[model samples]
Target: MSGEGNEPQAIRKLQPGKLVIASHNAGKVREIAALLEGRGLDVISAGDLDLPEPEETGTTFVMNAELKARAAADLSGLPALADDSGLCVDALGGDPGIFSARWGGENKDFNHAMGLVEDKLAAQPDAPRDAHFVCALALAWPDGHVEWFEGRVDGTLVWPPRGTKGHGYDPVFLPIGYDITFGEMDEPAKNEISHRGDAFRQMVAAVF
Candidate 1:
């Protein structure tokens, strides 16, 4: 099928060939690789390559994802997939959107990150404390072609991290109309409506 500008779709369908997942985070790699399993593709994490991680300096998720994917594709001479995701809080004026991981300063401590959220929302007199997780997925080819997909889940923030199953801000994020935080939900249940799932599904539609 023709893609934008009548360019042939950049990605070939998932097959037996190797595809690199450009992420050092094991959680992100597992989630994405699971989605691609049994679809006739061999999904490998960049970590498996022991390659140096590219710095994520882009301000937006798309740019960051593209940067990572292209860097991996160039390095490995294979198609690469990368994702950049974060929690965006409305009350904080969408703060911690791009810097969600480093919000607590340079410690990279998740507990510290979660603590910052509580502190930021403690004094909100009338704000909804609404938030969402945004995920952007990018696929890059060694030939310089690229494709992107995005997904999000609307939710609200709560005090006190609730569950230990999930990482990042999952413990405080309650999806719309749900009583439990993402941390409280099982992995299968959460993936069904997760931002990563949506974006990955989009990429699958494009390729497979």
Candidate 2:
């Protein structure tokens, strides 16, 4: 992590050493790692360290991200990064904002969760099918100091889904100004415009 001169005084600069990613989701971990590549940091996941996943009691994405980052930093005695991201549909009033993972149940079966989303929206097909993906990122030091960033990408929901590249609601999400769904796009293309990508860039500006 190279600190830029314009970094805020309140934000602690990371020095690109061993940092823990507070997550068990392989897709998320992989995305984060890809975003952080070439930053010269030795990154490791909390799952790799056998750290227990903490219950996400926060009502908001930022709060949940902070909770996970704090837990990992405290447990590993190292700097940590955490991300809480989900899909929010206007028709559903953000039904699965924080419970995106939970909607998949203990097995984390996203296919089942996607079916539920489709079923819930079937009753009102003409209703506003607009949606968005939101990502909140938190970086924490061992001493509990934290920096937060949030990003979102507006889009519309596609019925029956499409593609198979990305995870979560990617197959059903067609981002604004794009012809294909997120799942249909390549990794680099998706990363360039995703909610997580935006949040990660903000974090890099603040502390990297």
Candidate 3:
């Protein structure tokens, strides 16, 4: 077989300890850790290791995720998992897709960010309120081996952002077939159908 054919076939499975989550966001770290529960991987956050976050200069979700993952894996000398996720609103022409966190500004205030989303949507009342949450997960080894996965959950963007549970754009996002927002659901319930969960499951099957 050619090297090209064997390239993707090389799977680097995770060892049962000390995997780093390459993010400082408390919400992301907690959610990802929860999804990783019982997987035999000891999950730790970049914050826990005091690893400085790499600048996410990549445009797409996958690129950014890979950047973060590689940075952590190199710094911590451990396999690292990173997630780059966002709520993309169709009405806004996918505004804030990758820039979702930056929409929060220096304070990382999601309430302000949600209000901006609402304001933009409010300007165009005729536009569809449909949106989707996108998550890209990257698992990188210290040796530079990397595997990436992406997932999306379609939903609607609601006004008066409901619920107070989950973080980020959760309060305004109502997943399909459910009247409640992600912010309203408990960790277990949210983990079952989340974009992060979708990506996490794919990584687990391939890497863990």
Question: What's the TM-score of every candidate structure?
Answer: 0.90, 0.95, 0.95
RMSD of each: 2.4, 2.9, 2.7
List candidate 1 segments past 4 Å from native.
1-14, 104-107
* Superposed Cα deviation of residue 37, candidate 3 (Å): 0.9
Model 1 agreement with the true structure over 104-201: per-residue lDDT tens digits = 66656778898887787887768888899999988888987878788999998887888876677888899998898988987778888888878877
TM-score of 2: 0.95
lDDT of 3 at 26: 91
Candidate 2 has an lDDT of 0.88
By TM-score, how accurate is candidate 1? 0.90
Please state the error at residue 161 of candidate 2 in Å. Answer: 1.9
Per-model lDDT: 0.82, 0.88, 0.88
